[model samples]
Target: MNEHAVDILTELRDLVREFVRERDWEKFHTPKNLAVSLSVEAAELLEPFQWLATGENGELSAAKLDHVRHEAADVFIYLIGLADRLDIDLSSAVREKIAMNRAKYPAEKVRGDARKYTDYD
Candidate 1:
């Protein structure tokens, strides 16, 4: 992470850490288990988007949107827990990934195209 980047993740991570510590649930929150939990939460988050046609308006009712938000939060929280257990720096990882993607899909070559990098030729 860059020095100028906000330190918001630390606070959120600590909150998750404290919540786990208080519940004495660390024993059950193994890296593998956390990864599984994160995936499960992600699947749950996808529930709100299911059964929609390709052109269907994604806007949902207020209550259903709230449900989506809660499920999405569960996915994020579990991901933070998994990353904490794995000692992964998500900010740096994301930044590096974005850089790599930019290299793979240069604007000049990829402009107005949706092809894969391997198909650029």
Candidate 2:
């Protein structure tokens, strides 16, 4: 990832820490709570597209898109908080996951296919 992106994440992490500290919410930000909160926010993110056939096409009304944007931010915030509590570097973790996925789903073997890697065997 670019340095700018890493810097932004660091800035966000610090912002979240300050926000939590100011609110005296550190006691409530246990890894389990953050994990559950992350899941809840992620589920909320799907609400805008729950009944839409074209949801997969990225076609959402402006209002629905705005709702999704906020929900996505919530999910992202909780994710950052969770990573912070665990001392995990989000960017590096993402890079490692991408590398692992590339090995599991090689472009030549999985072109235009959406099946799991094990399904091909």
Candidate 3:
């Protein structure tokens, strides 16, 4: 089966809703708690590279890579859950942010360059 065959965010939202309803977890899934959970999961996702020395490539075994994948999925799941709880349309937000970033880093000046937006054009 194809992993990307479905609308993952919508499926995640439904699953979260069912989970919350089953466990009466809505009260505990407040925005504050969700934000904290998201941050913790994000940190977990970063664990594989956390101790890499500067300019050193971090390497991981297959099991470690699997762990990283799971952690990353957890972070995204929690983020979508939080967005559903708050009635936020995450896709729209991402689109708007991309537009904002394009304005900040216009291709005409930044194309093929690795400089920060504040650097000389």
Candidate 2 whole-model C-alpha lDDT, 0 to 1: 0.96
| Full-model lDDT for every candidate | 0.84, 0.96, 0.81
Q: Which 10 residues in a row give candidate 2 its minimum summed lDDT?
A: 50-59
| lDDT per residue (tens digit) for residues 23-120 in model 1 | 99999999999989988988887776777554134556666688778988888888889889999987887899999999999998899999899986
Candidate with the larger lDDT of 2 and 3: 2
RMSD each, Å: 2.3, 1.3, 3.9
- At residue 63, candidate 2 shows an lDDT of 89
Pairs of residues at least 3 apart in sequence or in different chains that clash in candidate 3: none
Ranking of all predicted structures according to lDDT, beginning with the best and ending with the worst: 2, 1, 3
Model 3 residue 28 lDDT? 91
Model 3: lDDT equals 0.81
Clashing residue pairs, backbone N/CA/C < 3 A, model 2:
none
Q: Clashes in candidate 3: how many?
A: 0
lDDT of 3 by residue, 18-116 (tens): 978899988899988999999999988777866656413347767777888899888987898888878897777877889998998889878898888
Q: Kindly provide the TM-score of model 1 when superposed on the true structure, using C-alpha atoms.
A: 0.85
